[model samples]
Target: MKILVINGPNINMLGIREPEIYGRETYDDLIAYIKEETKLLNIKVSFYQSNHEGNLVDKIQESYGKYDGIVINPAAYTHTSVALLDVVKAVGIPTVEVHISDPDSRDEFRKISYIRQACVTTIKGKGFKGYIEAIEYLVKHHS
Candidate 1:
């Protein structure tokens, strides 16, 4: 099994921007954590992050036969980007939405997510562990 991990917009600033909500882990730290977790799983994984919506959309659209499952943290795009959602729909892969902080506990705007309409599993408030859980579930359910 192969999995694609996509992170969008300002996620590259994870540790520096908000230590309270996003935690103090740098993007490299988070990537290392994901790599560590991936070692025990029966899948190969690739990770990508971009501050651009179009790049993320393109990456999602590119995942079709190249990947089996996707673990995505659409960041701010989760509430706003229909284009990103459309690419995910087009790819038709099993996806799990991950949030470092619980969107429900944040601003009202964050509470509404169009991506959730398409993805059944949303892991929130667990920090980087959400990424781990999402990948594991994808392995159990898809791979």
Candidate 2:
């Protein structure tokens, strides 16, 4: 199966940003891990990361008819972007929302996620492993 992995804003700073919360693994490390894990599952995965909200929305729109599923870590956008939620809904592809940190455990503002309702599932607090979990779920369920 083929999957699209979309990461948003500041996710590129995975290693340098917050060691305590996001772990010491670099963004490259995260990508490597996902690639390695999915390789074992015989899954084809494409990745996209952007600090721009419009780019992310465009990517989601572009995934239509091209990808089997989407694993998205919308980062800060998870709590806000209705545009993203709309596009995901419009695309009608199976989507899994991932968060490295549990948003409900953080600031009150972080607890709200506009994208959750649009996703088939939400994986949080599992760090980089959450991405793999989402991929596995899509492969097993969506495929």
Candidate 3:
């Protein structure tokens, strides 16, 4: 199986933007952790991250028939991007939404997730491990 991992907005600022909530692991560290944890699962994983909403939408559109499933952390966009939600629905790929912190437990503004309506599940508060959980969920259920 193949999975596309998509991150949005300030996600590239992991370990720097807000360590109190996002943790001390750099973005590269998170990537390495995902790779290491999933290497033995026999699934191919591809990653794409952008602060630009359009670029993220483009990537999601480009995935089309190219990927079996998607794991997305829309970050700040999760609260506002109806476009992301729409594209995910349009593409019709099995998608899982992930977050390093539990949005429901955060600020009131962070409680919303526009893309959740289009996803198979939402994994939050498990930190980087949430990505692995999402990948594994897709492997077990979507495949």
Candidate 1 clashes between residue pairs 3 or more apart in a chain or in different chains: none
Could you give candidate 1's per-residue lDDT for residues 15-128 as a string of tens digits? 899788888999999999999978978689999999999999888888889999999999999999998778888889999999988999999999988787677599999999
Q: lDDT of each prediction vs. the true structure?
A: 0.90, 0.95, 0.96
Q: Tens digit of lDDT per residue, candidate 2, span 19-122? A: 89999998999999999888888778999999999999999999999999999999999988999999999999999999999999999999999999999999
**Poorly placed runs, candidate 2 (over 4 Å):** none
Model 2 worst lDDT window (10 residues): 35-44
Error of 1 at 134 (Å): 0.3
* TM-score (C-alpha, index-matched) for candidate 2: 0.98
C-alpha RMSD of candidate 3: 0.5
Over the full model, what C-alpha lDDT does candidate 3 score relative to the true structure? Answer: 0.96
List candidate 1 segments past 4 Å from native: none
**Which prediction has the highest lDDT against the true structure?**
3
Clashing pairs in 3: none
